[model samples]
Target: GTDFPLDAALMLQEEMKAAFASHEFQEALGALHWATKDLKIAERNKQYRELLLEVQKLIVPRYGFEGTQKGMSLMLMAFQALGYNDDPTVDANTQAMNVLISMDVAGNALAERAAKEQARTSAALKPWEEVPWEVKKVEAP
Candidate 1:
């Protein structure tokens, strides 16, 4: 069998591009923009946190780690568009940290899923045990 090496980085990049191009992501960004405008510091902080948490919930289960990473990366990339620039009201560093934590959690989940799948596959492929003597017995010579 031919072994073709997988290019993880390229695959991730493609996945990120697809996510960025999705209508759901576009709607989320639009909502983020609407949600962050004209808010007091406390309100903005709460809203931002909730929004990120919601995004994490949506991405982790379906897309796994790579998808979550792509989602967060898109969010961070659009910070300026989302009106989270150098505004004193917004804690950009903390938000970035939240994304990192989400990515780590997703990564662990993906690894665990992969391990389980591998175990299941290995068990399925195991050789059958020997037949019992009684079962194997036939007409004797």
Candidate 2:
């Protein structure tokens, strides 16, 4: 597992928030809305409440501090928010599949953002052409 620098993680968090405001995110949310349209009121309410808690769980710790445990918890909460469950006997496999797909989408978006930030940072830190390089000579080859 790659450990993103704290700065990179913060940048990713901002990028993800921006993504959530995009039309694509709205469309995805719309799809979720339609999918659950037929659910009983109580069931819908329960799922929505659970989803809210999971989203908060995913966001708070990571934004506050960076660590392997926090990152793992965020990922786990992501899956849960997308409706994953541990019960194999349940017929919610479709929700599990949706979670996997959502994970891929979110992971790719974050990775792309991180890579761009890394590239920008690397370019800024690169030595200017005016700076002379020092080459060490080997006594023997």
Candidate 3:
């Protein structure tokens, strides 16, 4: 028996196949974006996380985040790559969105914050300050 999210996996597979066959890379990417959203909802499930990571590893490379710890999915990573590091300075109003998103009711709050803070720090650092070895290696090509 398979240890995968059978329904979601199969549906995504079929959708990807159809999109690729039709030369609809945009449609395929949209499908992947939704898949990532669904995976986030089921983050407690390791398989779901793996699936999302796999898709991200596959998709982000084409867009040029070839190597980074934060993975290539988040919007911030791309922005950072283009040199939009540093905290977006502004009044408290500008920080509200991030502050709200940063709150974690689960025990993983610290973990979440650490991840976000790390990403922010990484972003703020210039390319020379980035330690390539510190970033997690993508197991996939």
Candidate 4:
């Protein structure tokens, strides 16, 4: 196996987290974009795969969809990157689909409520309202 540069990648991830914490949106966006492009060499490596999911968990909501549960778009992207589609019964797929459904339902309900009560025309435009989503921790077998 090739020795992937895990240390550098981890450092970059930490830096991106700090940038976001400091409200340095530009840096965070750059980091998220770089991560989407790829931040590792070992796509087949288990550790690298985990890092990819972490990047997705971090990039989403803040930069993509709504709160984590209400937004599995990045998770779907991560699953695709990990080749989870090769198996029809993979729990990730079912879980992701559940999330997509919930996201849609939650979104519609929120938008309806907001429109009726607060005059918000779109729930997708409210990035300021998203909290960090609950992450379901699953260890790879």
Per-residue lDDT tens digits for candidate 3, residues 38-129, read: 45555534443353344445544444444233643443433445433333432232244233222132214444555899999877978755
Estimate the TM-score of every prediction: 0.30, 0.28, 0.23, 0.20
Give the top-scoring candidate (lDDT): 2
Backbone clashes (count) for model 2: 0
Write the residue-wise lDDT of candidate 2 on 60-125 in tens digits.
455543334456477456545544334342224434434433523544565566689999987784
Candidate 4, residues 118-139: lDDT per residue as tens digits? Answer: 6445535556456444444455
Off by over 4 Å in 3: 1-45, 67-69, 73-75, 79-141
Which model is ahead, 1 or 4, in terms of TM-score? 1
- At residue 56, candidate 3 shows an lDDT of 48
Residue 98 error, candidate 2, Å: 19
In candidate 3, what residue range of length 10 has the lowest lDDT sum? 98-107
Superior by lDDT: candidate 1 or candidate 2? 2
Candidate 1: residue 24 lDDT (0-100): 61
Q: Which ten residues in a row have the lowest lDDT in candidate 2?
A: 82-91
Window of ten residues with lowest summed lDDT in model 1: 1-10
Clashes of each: 0, 0, 0, 0
Minimum summed lDDT over a 10-residue window in model 4 is located at 1-10
